[model samples]
Target: MRIEPAFLFDLDGTLVDSVYQHVLAWKTALDAESIELSVWRIHRKIGMSGGLFTNQLLRETEVEIDPERIERLRRAHAEAYQRYASGIRPLPGARKLLAWFTEAAIPWAIATGGRMETAAVNLAALDVELTKIPVITRDHVRYAKPDPDLFLAAAERLDAPIEGAVVIGDSI
Candidate 1:
């Protein structure tokens, strides 16, 4: 028997217009550590996990390594990102696309690197019904995007098989 297809959508920049917000948030986090780096540099590493993002940024900037600062930086980014929560809104066609899926009875879930607090804001802004489906956040998985763990977890939560599942997002 052929299994039904399902979709996994990324939260930031996919369903919601938060790419630039993420860039600014990361910059703010780095700045909180008194680490001065170009926003352009941080922008390139947008979708990485908090830990990986900090490590990669430090490596690329050739800055002194400080393992203790990763948590501080993450907390700073979380705080900085929360400021933009009220400004967040669904992207054009996001509602339509999700509605189409709903109407067609297709199962879809959110797979994101964003934390639950921020994800909750975006979902509320989009009016997405998490009760009906599942969301796989960075907290749910060890690795971030480009890693299949999030995808796998989302599928499992939605009871969708991996073979025919698809991920829809703004980034690669």
Candidate 2:
């Protein structure tokens, strides 16, 4: 018998409406460093790892950030994100879509660019059952989207083939 296709869902923009919330959080964090970035620019780096995201923004804007500042910025972002995470919610039909996949016996998991702390908050906000769900977050992989590492990890966790797996996310 042929194996079924395993689905990898992105937690931020795709399933939940936390994209802008993330922007605000990052902005707040960067503000602490006195680094100002346009929301559009921040949004563009949302799907990348924290270090890569910071480096990209700095490169694009021609700014300078030391290693200590980078570490501080990461911590600040996580704290700020949690502070503003209460307002997060699921996207239209996100719950229904998850339910449909569950009821249909589809294999799925969350592969997100979010940190584990924020992932837990978003998952609780959405009330999505994750007892058996495998979630691969930024902490789990060396790279983020467009790299296929996250999806590949999820597929491995699901014991499914990667060739036929479909990734679902709202980011460009």
Candidate 3:
């Protein structure tokens, strides 16, 4: 007997062209807080956990930030991302690929470094119906990308084992 493989996808740049939108949103957030980090610098931390991103930002910029300010930045980034959400679209063949998997009776799920607060927008852009799809976001797990938690949760949701899962993502 052989177990079927599962495909785990990342939402942002992999499915939707929303990487730069997130980058810009973070820029807006940093700017709102009077933090002077360059966009390129922010892009380097795009697909990691937000807590880790903030910690890295502080470490690289040598800026002192409190928990309150960090929360404010997160709120600001979410708001800013909404402003850019309308411009986001599914990457070419992304919807097709998912549909193909569905047609083939393959188990698949979306796992993103973003929280539901933000992944919701990308999912909408991808035209993925959350009612029928298993999406694991940062809100669902203790950690995000580069940690395996999101993918692990997604596999669990699909009732698939992590051992032979294929992760499709643009970044770590």
What is the full ranking by lDDT, best candidate first?
3, 2, 1
* Candidate 1, residue 159: how far the Cα is off, in Å: 1.2
Task: For candidate 3, write residues 42-132 as lDDT tens digits.
Answer: 9988987777788789778888868998899888999999999988999999989899999999999999888889999999877888999
Ranking by TM-score: 3, 1, 2
**Model 2: how far is 158 from its true place, Å?**
0.3
Q: Candidate 1 lDDT, tens digit per residue, 1-172?
A: 8988999999888899887887888888888888899989988888776777888889877878786777788888888988967678889989898989889989999998877866788888778887886888988998887778888999999888999799887777
Per-model CA lDDT versus the true structure: 0.84, 0.85, 0.89
Q: After superposition, how far is residue 126 of candidate 2 from its true place, in Å?
A: 2.1
Give the Cα error of residue 116 in candidate 1, in Å.
Answer: 1.0
Best by TM-score: 3
Assess candidate 2 and give its lDDT.
0.85
* Alpha-carbon runs more than 4 Å astray in model 3: none
Per-residue lDDT of candidate 2, residues 1-172 (tens digit): 6768999998988899888888998899888888888888898778676778887787786777689878888899889999988789998899889888889989999998777877888888767667778889888998877688888999999999998798898766
- Which structure among the candidates has the greatest lDDT? 3
